[model samples]
Target: MLSEKMIEQLNEQIKYELFSGHYYISMAAYCASKDLEGFANFFIIQEQEERFHAMKFFHYINEQGGDVKIIGLDQPKTDFKSLEEVFDLAWRHEQFVTKRIHKLMDFAIEERDHATQSFLKWYIDEQVEEESTMLSLLRKIQLVGGKGHGILMLDGELAKRQFTPPAA
Candidate 1:
């Protein structure tokens, strides 16, 4: 059974994940408005991934005999002046998520919840990949600049992105 403190923290994390999904969807809308179809597609996939992440936590909490609480999500920004800005925000958000995951891991360790700790190990590793991927995209965006041809090339590259849901 999860302690009340752990359940509270996990609920907060779930809200954050839900917010991430909303944020990505907002980004997708912004991309679509800007006529960057590929970029929009990327964020649409990201939104789905974020939803999956939240569901994983939801199911895990229930599996551990903890209460699963639904929380309201904050609105995400839907406007971006440039692709660089969009990608920069994404990279920063991933870094933020990494820190959040680390905090959860620390909490689990402090409570000596071995099962929670073991479960969180996957998230810790996943956050690393998440941050790395966003950072890589940011670097590529920096290289491309905000010019038309550059943006087109980046869009083409983004079009190749495919979402593969994480294994159960």
Candidate 2:
């Protein structure tokens, strides 16, 4: 059974994951407005991935005999100055999430909850991938001077991205 504190933290993480999905949706809207359909598709895929992540926590909490709480999320930023700005924000968001996950891992270790620690290892690895992906995209945008034909090519590449949920 999960301690109350652990349960509370897990519930909060669920909220954060859902908020990430919402934020990605806002980014997608911004991309679509700029006629960057590929970029929009990429964000949409990211949103789906966030939702999947939230569900994983939800299921894990339930399996561990913890109450799953549905909580409110703050509104996400909807405006973007440019594609580069959007990617920069995404990379920063991923870093924020990585810190949160590490904090959770620290708590689990402090509590000596081995099962929770083991479960969180997957999320830790996932955050690494998330951060790398966002940073890579940001770098690519910068390399292309953030405009023109290169941007279109990048968009096309992003459009081909599809969400494939990892094995649990």
Candidate 3:
């Protein structure tokens, strides 16, 4: 069973995850509006991942015999001035989520909640990959300066991205 404090923290993280879904979907719409189909596809996949992340928390909380508290999320931005701005926001958001996951891991360790710690290990590794991917993409965007044929080439590459559901 999870402690009340642990449950509270986990619920907060769930809210954050849900908010990430909202944020990414809105970004996806913005990309679509700009006719950046590949970028739109990328953000849409990100949106789905965030939903999966939130559901993971929901299932875990219930499995732990905790009452899942559904929290409200703030509105997400729907407009972007440029592709660079969209990607910059993504980079910043991923960094923020990485910090939140690290904080949760620290709390789980302090509480000696081995089950929670073990569960969070998946998320820890996920966050590492998430940040790495975002940083690598940001670097590529920087190299291209969000202009000319380079952006189109990158878009073509991102267009092929499809979300493979996690293994059962």
Candidate 4:
């Protein structure tokens, strides 16, 4: 069973996860406007993954006998000066999310909630991969000079990215 505080925090995380999806879709739109179809495809896949993450929390909350509350999202940034800037922002965003997940894990440890800790372990692992992906992509963009042939090559690579839900 989850404490009321834990439930509330988890609900807040759900909102964050959903907002991540929204934010990525906004990024996708920006990429599309720039005629970066591959980049757009990448963000679209990212959006789908975020939604999947939100649903995981939604189901977990219910399984733990907590009421799941849907929260409103603020507008995501829709404008970007360059693809490198977008990836830089995305990498920073992932860092922020990693911190949030760590804080939640600390709370779980404090409460001696073994089940919650175990559940959060998956997220802790996921955050590592998330941050790494963003950083790697950002570095690639930087190395590629953020435009022309290099950017096109990266776009083609990202276009092949598909959202594959992790096995339950």
Candidate 5:
């Protein structure tokens, strides 16, 4: 069974994940408006991934005999000044998520919640990949530097991204 505090924290994380999905979808819409289909596809995949993450937490909490509480999600930004800005925000968000996952792991250790700790290990690894992918994209964007052809090439690369959920 999950401790009340842990349950609360998990619920909060669920909300954050849902908000991440919303944020990515908004980014995808912005990219579509800018005629960056590849970028839009990338964010579309990201949005699906975030939704999966939230559902994973939801299922885990219920499996642990905890009630899944729904929390309010803040509105996500619908517009970005440039692709650089979008990638910057995405990288920053990944960093934030990594911190949050680390905190959850710390709490699990302190509470001797071995099950939760084991489950969180997957998330820990996932965050690493998430940050790495975003940083790589950011670097590519930086190298491209507003060149139309370079941007198109980068977009094509991003469109190739496919989400494979980690096997539990």
Candidate 6:
């Protein structure tokens, strides 16, 4: 069973993950409104992935015999000036999540919750991939200046992205 502090932190992370979904949902709307269907597809997939992450944490809490505390969802930014701004926001959000994950890992270490720490190793590895993908996409957006046919070409590229469900 998870200790009180560990349970609290895990619950908090669930909230963050849900908010992360909302963040992507908002970006998806912005992308759709801009007529960037491929970019929109990317964030729509990201939104699904974030909710999946939240559910993973939720199930982990239950699996660990802890009470799941469902919390309110905070608002996310609904507008952006350009595709570059959208990807920049995504990159920054991923960085923020990485920092939060580190803090949670540090707490789990301090508390000596071996099970929790072990579970969080997945998140640690996931964060690396998340940050890397966002940064790489952001750099590409910057390189192309997100204008004219460049973004359109990127749209075609991003359209090919598919969400591979994580292993059960």
Q: Give the best candidate by TM-score.
A: 2
Question: What does candidate 2's lDDT look like per residue over 1-168, in tens digits?
Answer: 899999999999999999999999999999999999999999999999999999999999999999999999999998799999999999999999999999999999999999999999999999999999999999999999999999999999999999999888
* Candidate 5 structure quality by residue, lDDT tens digits, 1-168: 899999999998999889988988888998999999899999999988998899999999999999998988898997699988998999999899999999999999999999999989989998999899888888889898955899999888878978877576
Q: Considering lDDT, where higher is better, how would the candidates rank from best to worst?
A: 2, 4, 5, 6, 3, 1
What local distance difference test score does each model get? 0.89, 0.97, 0.89, 0.91, 0.90, 0.90
lDDT of 6 by residue, 92-136 (tens): 999999999999999989998888889989999999999998989
The number of the candidate with the highest lDDT is 2
Question: Which 10 consecutive residues of model 6 have the lowest summed lDDT?
Answer: 159-168
Score residue 84 of candidate 4 by CA lDDT. Answer: 86
State which candidate, 1 or 5, has the greater lDDT.
Answer: 5
Question: Alpha-carbon error at 7 in model 2, in Å?
Answer: 0.3
- The candidate, 1 or 6, that scores higher on TM-score is 6
Tell me the deviation in Å of residue 156 in model 6. Answer: 0.8
Question: Model 4 lDDT vs. the true structure?
Answer: 0.91
Q: Write down the worst ten-residue block by lDDT for model 3.
A: 159-168
lDDT of 4 by residue, 1-168 (tens): 999999999999998899888988988999999999999999999999899889999999999999999989999998788888898888888888889889989999999999989998998999899899989999999997888899999999999999899765
- Indicate the worst ten consecutive residues by lDDT in candidate 4: 159-168
User: What is the TM-score of each predicted model, taking all chains together?
Assistant: 0.95, 0.99, 0.95, 0.98, 0.95, 0.96
Give me the displacement of residue 12 in model 5, in angstroms.
0.8
Clash numbers, per candidate: 0, 0, 0, 0, 0, 0
lDDT of 5 at 53: 91
Worst lDDT run of 10 residues, candidate 2, spans 159-168
